[model samples]
Target: MVRILRGLAHKYFSDEEAVILFLLLVTGTIFVIWFGAMLAPAIASLIVAFILQGLVSKLNRMGVPQTVAVISVFLVFMGVLIGFIFGLLPLIWTQVSTLAGEAPRIIRELQSYLSLLPQEYPHLVSEEAVNLIYAEISAEVGHATQWLVSFSLSSIPDLVALLIYMVLVPILVFFFLKDRELIVNSIGRLLPPQRPMMVRIWHEVNLQCANYVRGKAVEILIVGGTTYVAFKLLGMPYAALLSLLVGLSVVIPYIGAAVVTVPVAVIGLFAFGWSSQFIWIMVVYGIIQALDGNVLVPVLFSEVNNLHPVVIIVAVLFFGGIWGLWGVFFAIPLATMLKAVFAAWPVQEDIPAPAQEA
Candidate 1:
């Protein structure tokens, strides 16, 4: 069996294309196995939180101690959460209540608009069909809102877990930062002397993962802030809530901006009667998209990850279909990790000098 495995590895690596295919297969299999295990989501969330805490460690190097930095970062995040809940929640609750109260009127308007269509079209869509559609849509909206509320309520346990994690994270991060060199040396000792190539690959993967996480955090903040400010200035209802949605949705990549814009525009139109405010909402979203596409994405997330956009879209759809919100949230990070694995095989390239030297 050992001899047969060795022969197969020799044959597989002899052909470059075959080697690539073999690597892809191995990566996919590993992902499936890991993802299928019930612990994948929790593991992914931990990795995310670790990355954020690692950033706090970097900030600590600028002056603060790890414990103080971690506390400071957590406090800042908490302040933002409190501000959002207090400032935005009331406005959103009021607007949502108003929208609910006007639901019957909106239904009437929709019916009137639908009635104007040709009889042939109307025949294609029966009264029962329209009612079913409305009922399904309304039910879905209610379910989504309920899920959000329930998720918030459910977070109490998660918060307790987080507090526990927070205490552990800083201790972990401090040692990680201080002993990073020792960790590298320890890993090197585990590998065979001839496998410096594997060490290089590991280093590359670490850099990619770190950059991707940091870039994403920055991108989300900028986009979310822009959306919030734009809506607030235009006096759009639920500006903060919509901005949060937009910011959070961006984790899903291209579809996120559009997903956020549709509901915001629809609600604005309904609440403000398709007037200047509605138009301004459309304009704001358009500008936001333009900035994200042209400036923000290019500046923050220029790494190609070697996956086609089509592959990304499909991953988002498939994972999102199964795991819902968490799937969408982690899709890009997982994809990026997969890309790093693919790029890990030995390749000769020059290392660029630091920008200061350049």
Candidate 2:
């Protein structure tokens, strides 16, 4: 066992650079896990700056001055941020509150529908099962309603933190972009002068993560905006809320769409039960999802290597468990980064045994 352990270590960690890289990774993971909440604003700023860096680089490559590029990108970012905060957030919040207010009514309607399920599918569904399911749903809805009320009452502290983030993130992002090279060089100075393994891993991670994150952002906007327009044109209630959910659903690949579909279908049924409008809404939704998967994804992620569906789902569950919503959002990128790391990781090739005389 001792010999085997030593052999494995020597095979995997033979390179000094590999050992240094491993230590760095472990240290970074520990730092994030321990202090993630306290340093959320800085981390968020770093992410935003990382995303915006591509645009800054593009502008610089076009012969624009570095300062001009930074300012231009920052202004556009601020514009979008303002619009999201003032324009979209209010609409979504209103819909959410409205939905909460009508939860009891919706629950009653759902209960009524489920009560009929046992009769309609007597062999498949039992009355007792239907009753139990309704009980669970009612309990969940009650909990959700209570949470909304409590959250509203206790949101002042959260709002203050949000405001702090709003102020600090843009400022930090601006400085990070403006001094991008300086920051890179400063960190580079802390590392060994010769670090081919780390360099390779960094490049691979950057290519995979940067492209994915940017593509996802664009995809979310397109999907969400399209969904909102479709829902509104179809006269669907809670268009903004449903659209936002639909947009964010893309982050979780298969599961999100499936989960969000339940609400969309329930709302449509409640609004236009057994009607052509409900049918049309479902049709439009299906079309949007089809186009997103078949068209938009191909265009946006043309350069990206797609992870397997199972891997993606597992990543979503694992990372989401660890970091909540942010984990879910970045699950794919994080998984891809891990894949890249392993692919680029240095390992000693096994030695071949000398052939015996034939």
Candidate 3:
């Protein structure tokens, strides 16, 4: 068996297709190992928090004292959280309550409309089909509501865990910030002596990760603020909550903005009776999204990790399948790390230099 494995490895490494297959197998194995490990999620979250702390440390290098910088960043985060709770929570609660009160009337109106459709086109469809559709819709909505309730109940444990994690994150971040250089050097020391290039690759990867995290935080704040202000000016209900959702959703990459926008628009349409007010809500979301994608992201996050859109989509889907929301949250970071690893392989090309005089 050993001799056969050796022969296969030799043959595989000699051919391009075989080499690609081998790499894929290795990557899959690594992913499985990482996922199966008990500490993976905690470690990933801690690393992310540490990266944010390091950003604060960088500010300290620019003349801000360490204590002041940490306090300032923490205060800013708290202020934003407080503002969101005060400005958005009540409005959302009110709107949601109003919508709930109106749901039966809306359903009756929908049924009436569906009934009219068959009379208007008697030969085209049957009343039973229309009834079936309505029944299905009702059933789906009921299930959705039940799921939401269950989700809220289940979230209590997760919320407790999150609070614990939050406490640990600050402690970890403090140590990370204080001994950043030592950590890097220790990681480098773990690599084999023959692989000096690994150290340089690690440095590059760290830099890319740092830039991505810092830029993303800035992008989230800008986009969230823009959304909140736009919704407020347009007299949209739950403006702050919707904006906060949109902003937090931005961390998921391609689909996050859409997830927040579509629900908000649907709720607006239902609440406002599909009038011009609903249209304005859509327009507000569009403007916020356009600015976020074209301006804020490009300007702030341009130099961060550069993964292909396809890879990001796959990672989002894959991780989201495994861990739900938290998976979605960390998808891009994991993809970034994978991209860095792939780029570090010898087969990847370096940037070409311009032709020089002899």
Best model per lDDT: 2
- Report RMSD (Å) for each prediction in the order shown: 9.1, 1.7, 7.3
Sort by TM-score, best first: 2, 3, 1
Model 3 Cα lDDT, one tens digit per residue, 1-358: 9766655555435435436545655886577656744654457545655556765877888999876777676665556546656766667666655555556676777788789878998899789999998998778766655655576687898878866765665556556555666887896565445543455556666767777777777878788888888888878766766777888888887778767766686567656766888887787788778887888777876777667789889999998887777678978977786677556544423334469999
User: Could you give candidate 2's per-residue lDDT for residues 1-358 as a string of tens digits?
Assistant: 9777777788789899999989999999889988999999899899899999999989989999999999999999999999999999999999999999999999999999998999899999999999999999999999999989999668889989999999999999999999999999999999999988899989988888888888888999999999999999999999999999999998778888899999999999999998999999999999999999999999998877788999999999899899998888778888988988887898896545469998
Q: Which regions of candidate 1 are displaced past 4 Å?
A: 1-8, 11-50, 53-129, 142-194, 303-306, 321-323, 346-358
* Candidate 3 vs. true structure, TM-score: 0.72
TM per candidate: 0.68, 0.96, 0.72
* Candidate number with greatest TM-score: 2
How should the candidates be ordered by lDDT, best one leading?
Answer: 2, 3, 1
Superior candidate under lDDT, 1 versus 3: 3
Clashes of 3: 0
Cα lDDT listed for each candidate:
0.68, 0.91, 0.70
| Ten contiguous residues minimizing lDDT sum, candidate 1 | 345-354
Give lDDT tens digits, candidate 1, residues 177-220: 45556777996675466655455656777777777787878778
Instruction: Report the error of model 1 at residue 42, Å.
Output: 6.7
Model 1 global lDDT (CA atoms, 0 to 1)? 0.68
